[model samples]
Target: MSEEKSPFVVSASWLEDRLDDQNIRIVDAAWYLPAHNRNGRAEYEAGHIRGAVFFDQDEIADKTTGLPHSVPSPEAFAAAVGALGIAETDTIVVYDGPGLFSAPRVWWLFRIMGARKVFVLDGGLDGWKHEGRALVTVQTTPQPATFTPTYNGDAVTSFDAMRAIVDNGSVQIADARGPGRFLGTEAEPRPGMRSGHMPGALNLPAGSFASDGRLKTLAELKTLITEAGIDLDRPIVTSCGSGVTAATITLALHSLGHTDNTLYDGSWSEWGSRSDTPVTTEPTPKKDR
Candidate 1:
C-alpha cells in the first residue's frame, strides 16, 4: 500500500508544533447529529485547542434554503471567515470531535471558497486530548481580517443538475450513508423522509475511509473506492444524509488525485424529502468499470 501522506491532512503533532504560528488558524469545526446527543458549541466552550476558534456549521451555512448546513454564499462565507480572523492566505486547519466526520466539509468549503491553504487535522480534538495536549476554556478573540472569496461554482452540484444526473447517469453518485439506510432496510433518522437510495447511486459509506480519527492510506482508499465500484477516471458526485459526511468521500477522492468530482450540497436531505425525485431500494450490481 502506498504510504504517502495527504497534503490535505496534517498530523496532530504538526499542528501542536505550530500552534503559536501567526499565520496558522486552527478551527474547531465540530458538529454532531442530534442523535449523537452532544452540543458542539457547549463542548468547545468546555475546552478547545489553544488559539482555536469555533466554527458553527449550521450558522455559517446558507440559511435561506432551510436545508441543514447548506453551502453559504461567497459574500456570506467571506464575512464569516473574516470575522473569525481568517484570511485567504492563512494556513487554515479544521478539526471536528470525531476526527474525520464534519471537518472535511469545512475543508471542502474553504477550498471551494478559494482558500488554497486549507487542511483537516488528522485524528481530531479527541485524538489531541488523548495525546495529553493542553486545551483552554478561554475563547480566542482575533482581530478581524479581510477575506476575499473567489467561489468555485463548479465545485457545488445544484438540485437541478443532480436531477439531470440521476435521470441520465451523467455522473456517478457516491452516497456516504450507511448500507442499511442506503439499501432502504433501515429507518431514516429524520422524520417524514423516504427510505432508500437514488437510482444507480453507489454506496460508499464515509466511515469506511477512516480509522481511529485518521484517514487511511492512499492505497487503501483506492481499494475501498474500487470495492464500492466507483470508477476513478469518471466524474463523481458525492452525497450524504445532509451533505456533511459527503465531503469525507470528496476528501478521499481528492487525496487519490481525482479532481473531477462535485459535492451535491442538498444531498439526501433534499432528495428524499421531495416527491419529484425517484427513490429506489434495489442495489447496483457490482462490475468492472
Candidate 2:
C-alpha cells in the first residue's frame, strides 16, 4: 500500500503549530442534519476555534438548484470566501463539529475553486476540544480580501454528466450513505425522495473512512476502497445524502493519490427524485464472502 500523505488533510497538531500565522486561515464548516436539530451558525457564535471563520454550507451553495447544498459557481464561491478574508494563496484549514464530516466538503470546495494549500483539519473541533485546545467565544472579524477563483470544471460532476456515466458505466459511482439507505431498506431523510442508490454505485459509508474523527491511514484507506470492489485507476464520482459526506470519499481518494475523481454536488437528492434516473434496491452481491 502507498504511504503518501494527502495534501487535503492536516492533523490538529499541525494546525496548532501555525495558529499565529497571518496568512493561514481556518474555517469552521460545521453543519448538521435537520434531524440532529442543531444550528451550525448558532453553535459557531457560541464558541469556535480562535480566528476561524464560519463557512455556511447553505449560504455558499448553488442557490438556484433545488437540490440541497449544491456547489456554487466559481464566481459566487470566490466572492463568499473572499468576504471571509480568504484569498487564493492562503493556506486554509477547515474543520467541523463532528470531526470528519462536513470539513471535507469545504476542503473539496476550495480545491475545486482553484485554491492551493487547502486542507481539512483532522478530528475537527471535537478533536481539538478533546485535546483541551483553547477555543474563543468572541468572534474575530478580518477585513475581506480579494479572492480570484479559477474554476476547475473537472473536479465537479453535473447531473447530465452523471446520467451519462450511469448509462455507460464509464466511471465508478460511490455512495457514502448508510447501508439501509443504500439498499432502499430505509426512507430517505429528505421528504419526497425515494430510497436507494444510483445504478452500479457501490455503498461505502463515509464513517468507514475515519475513526475517532481522524482519517484512517493510507494503507487502511486503500484496503477499504479495494474491499468495496472499487478500481482506484478508474475515474470515480462520489455522492451522498446531500453532498456533504460525499466529500469524505473525495478526501480519501485524494489521500490515496487518486486525482481522477469528482464530487456529484446534486448527489442522491437529485438522482433519487428524478423518475427517469436509474435506481437500485438490490444489495451488492458478495463474492463468496
Candidate 3:
C-alpha cells in the first residue's frame, strides 16, 4: 500500500467554523501521567472544545494485558466509539490538553481502526483557548452510531515482534523517552521501571517535536528528527514508557511523509517489565548525518 497522502493536522480556526456540522466529530483524547495529578475524565466533564466527546484512554483498552493503555480489540473499539456517536464516515478530529501529546495515540488508533478522515487539532485545547474561542461546560449526547473496525495489522508491533526486530536489526527502533532515560542518566518517571532503552534503539524524546506546547512546523520536525539520528527513509518502530508518547514520533514521521513505521503497543512498560527480555543501561549512540 502507498503512504497516506493527505495532511492530518488541522488548526483551531478551521474547527471553529465547523463546530455545528453534523457530519464532523470532535474528540477530547486528553490524558495525563500519574505525576501530573490531573483527572482526564473530570476535566472533560467540566469543559472542552464546544462539542467534543471524551475518549478515556484507560477505559477503552485491552484489560487482559497487565499493561497500561494497551490497544483495544477491534470489537471493543467499534463499540466504544460507536457509543460515543462517532461514525466511520465522520471527519474525526482529536485533541489533548497540550498540543500533540497523547492525542496522536487516538489518531493512530482511528487510522488502524479504519477511520479515513481522522485528524489531530494542531494546537490542542490550549491553542483553541489561546485564540479566545469560547468553551462551555454543557455536555452533548449525539445519536449512537454504528462503526465497523478493520484492523490494520501493520500499524502495531507485538512484544515478540519487537524482540525479533531487535535481533534482526531490520527495523529501526526509535525510543521516545528523554535522552536521560535513554542513556540511564535519569530515573524513570514510573517507579520500578528500568532505565535505558532497548538495544539498538535511538532516542527521540517526544517533547522535542513541539515548542511552547504546540507541534512545530514541518521543517522544524524534520530537523528535530534527523538530528536525533533517525533516517526517515528506513523502516522504524516507535516505543516509549507506556506506548503513549511513542505515537508522537509516529505522528511526526507520518507528517513527514514517512509511512513505513509502526508503534510497539507494549512499549517499555511491557518490555522493561519482562524478565526474559534483554535490556541495557548503556548507550552506543548512532551518528546521524
Candidate 4:
C-alpha cells in the first residue's frame, strides 16, 4: 500500500516553485549535536537555499533554563520569528541539513506557537544540493513582520507531569535516542548524565523513520511504531537527548493520524541529568499497556 500524503511536508520541487511567493517564508532550521561536530550557523552561512533565513535553535530557546533547546516563552518566540519576517499567517517551510532530522522540531514549534501553515521540506538542504539545486552564500536580510503567538500549553509535558506518567504509565513514552543509549549500553553524548532511559519508555530512534535523509512512507512508519510497542490509542510523550529529535517521533505520529501526543521539552537533558528521576536499562515489555 502507498503511504498517505502528509499535509505537513512539501517536496523540494514544490518549495523551489514557490521561492518567490510573497506570502511564503522559507527557514533553514539546521541543528546538530556536539558529537556530530558540525555547526548549524556556520553551515548556513557557508551556503543555503536562496532567500532562506536561519533559525538558531539554541539562540531562540528558553535560556533561563539550563536545559538545551528548551521551549521559549510565547513572547520570546514571537519576537524571534517576527524578526525573521515570518508572520503566523505565512506559509512557512522549514528544512534542516539532513532533511528529516531537526526540521520537524521547528515545524512543531511553529504549530504550538499558533502558526497554521508550517511545513517541513521533504528533502532537506543536503538532498537539495545533491540534486544540483540552487544555493547562495550571501546572507538574507528579511523585512521584519509582526507575529502574534498563542501558546498551546497542552502540547508541552512538564517534568512533574512526566514523573506522574512514568509512575502510573498513563501515557506511553517514546525515546528517540539510539538503541545503545536507550538501553544504557552506550555512554550519553552529554557529559555527567545518566545512561539509561526513563522507566517504561520505549525506544524509537529518530533515524528509523527516515532513509537517506528523507522520511519513510506512512505504512512503514506505522509498522515501525507497532514494532516499537507504541500504542497509538494511548497518549504519547516523545523525548530525546535534548528535546530536539523527539519532534521527529511526534511528526511521525501526527502523519499517521495520531493527535493525542506531546513532546517532552526537557527530555533526557533534564531527566538524565537530574538525580531524582528514575532510569532503567531493561526493555519495556511490548504492548503491556
Candidate 5:
C-alpha cells in the first residue's frame, strides 16, 4: 500500500474520495474582511463543501478580549467544538474560501487543543469548486460529540509574553502581515490602530506562502523562511493583523516538523493599540531582508 500523506494537508481529490468516511469531519473556516462586504456564515449558507460544518472564526472567538479573534479559553474552545459535534478523535479537515487564508487558524487551533489527526484542505474551497466538485447549500448538523481538550499553553503567546520575547530576543518574531503594512507604507485596515510593526520583528506575509489559493510545497515553504533570514531551528513567534493569519506561519512551521513555534494570539491589534508597547515606522533594514 502507498504511504499515507501527512495528516497536516490533503489534496482536493484525496478528500473527495474519502468524503463519506464516517471518521472524517470537515470544517469550513471561510472568512473575509468587512472591506470585502462578505459574510462568512452567509456565504457558507449559500454553498459549501458537502458534510462540512462551518467553523465561524469571528463568532467562535473569546469576546472578553478586546483584541479581535483572541484565543478562547480551553473550556470555551471545548464547548464550541463539542457543540459542532467534533470529537477529539475525529480526522478533521479544515478549509477556507480563498485557500490558505483563515483556515490555518482553525487548523492550528485544533493542533494546540491536542487533536491527534487534523489537516488543512490543499487549495481550499476555491480549488475544490474550480475542479467542478459538488457543493451543497443544505446544512450539516452533526450530533454533539464530546471533545476533551488539553490546551498546549506553550503553543500560544499572550501580549505580555510577546513583550518579554521582544525584550529578551528569545524567540524569532515572524510578522505575517504584508510588507506594506509591516513597513508602515500602507494604512492599517482597522481604525484607531497605529501603522507599522513591533520592534525587532521581521515581515513574512502569509499571502506569499501560497499561489492561486493553494500553499506551496514543503521545499518552497522552507526556502521562503530561510530566504527571509529566519533560522528554522530557532523558536518562532508568529504574528499578523489581529491573530488569524499568524496561524499560517505556525501551520507552515508545523508542516516542516518544527515544533518550537507559537502564535502571538493578539498580534498587531494589541501591540499597536497599547500606549506602552513601542511601535516602529522605520522600514526594516535591507541587510535584514
Candidate 6:
C-alpha cells in the first residue's frame, strides 16, 4: 500500500521551519474539562510553542448556548480569531497541551468557518517540547486583523440534524467516548449527565488515533477504523463526551482521506441527557489485536 496523505495534521519539523515566516500563524488552542481542574490558560502562559497566540475555547465559543463548548457562529468565530491576528490566507497551526485532544476541535472549527490553510500540530506542545523545540513563557500580543468567515454548514451536525440521523440511519454515528462510558458502566465526567452511547453508534475512542502524544501513521489509522468496523467510504458523524475529542476521530478520518464526515457538536451531552433519545449499552467486541 502507498503512503496516505495527511489532511489536517502537520509535523513539528515542518512548523519549525516556518516559525519565522510572517504569514504562518500558530495558535495554542488548549482546553481542559472542568473535571480535570487544570487551567489551560495558565499552562499556555507558562510555556508554549514560540509565537503561538492562545485561543481560549471557552472565551471564543457561543456564550448563548447552555451546552459545553458549543461552536460559535461564523461571525463570532471570525471576530474572536481575527483578534488574534490570524487572516484567512495565513497558514494556521493549532496545538494544545495534550497531543491530539483539543487541537483538532479548533482545526475543525477553522475548516467549518472557511479557513483554507488550517492544520493541527501533530503531537501538540508535548511533542514539540519533547523534541527540544524552543518555547516562550512570555505572552505576545498580536495586532488584530480583519477576518471574514464563510460558514460551511455541511461540516457540522446540529442537534436536530443528529436527531434525524439517529432516526433515519442515513449517517453513521461514531462515538469517541471510552468503552466504559459507551457501555454505561462508568459515570460521565460531567455531573448530572446520563451515561450511555447513542443508539447504533460505534465506539472508537480518540486515544486510538495517537500514541505518546503523536498521531499514528495513516495505515495505522485506517487499520484502527477498519477494525472498529467503521466504513471509511460512508458518511460518518463523530461524537464524544462533549464535542471536543470527537474532532480527533474527524482528524483521523480526514488523515485517511475520508472527507465525507461531520462532527455532532452536542454529542452525548445532548443525546444522553434527553429522555426521548435512544440509548444503548450493548458492548461491541474488539475487532483486531
lDDT of 1 at 268: 90
Per-residue accuracy of model 1 over 75-164 as CA lDDT, tens digit each: 999999999999999999999998999999999999999899999999999999999999999999988999999999999999999999
Candidate 5 per-residue C-alpha lDDT over 103-203 given as tens digits, one digit per residue, 9 for 90 to 100:
99999898888797999998998899899999999999988989999889988898899999888878888999999889899988898888899877888
Question: Model 4 Cα displacement at 260 (Å)?
Answer: 0.4
In order, the Cα lDDT scores of the candidates are 0.93, 0.88, 0.87, 0.92, 0.86, 0.86
Candidate 3 C-alpha lDDT tens digits along 1-289: 1322227788888899999888999999999987778777788888788889999999999989989999999999999999999988889999998877899999999999999999999888878888899888888786899988889978999998999998888888899988888888888877777778788888899988877566777788887788778888899999999999999999888888999999999998888777778787776477521
How many angstroms is residue 265 displaced in model 2 relative to the true structure, after the best TM-score fit? 1.1
Give candidate 5 misplaced runs (Cα > 4 Å). 1-7, 285-289
Error in Å for residue 215 of model 3: 1.7
Q: Report the lDDT tens digits of candidate 4 across residue range 170-217.
A: 999999999999999999998989999998999999999888787888
Q: Candidate 2, after superposition: displacement of residue 221 in Å?
A: 0.4
Model 2 TM:
0.95
lDDT score of residue 21 within candidate 1? 98
Q: Residue 234 lDDT in model 3? A: 90
lDDT at position 35, candidate 3: 74
**Distance (Å) between predicted and true CA of 70, model 4?**
0.5
Could you tell me how far off, in angstroms, the CA of residue 70 lies in candidate 1 after the best superposition? Answer: 0.9
Per-candidate TM-score against the hidden true structure: 0.98, 0.95, 0.94, 0.98, 0.95, 0.94
**TM-score result, candidate 6:** 0.94
Question: In model 4, which regions exceed 4 Å deviation?
Answer: none
How many pairs of residues collide in model 5?
0
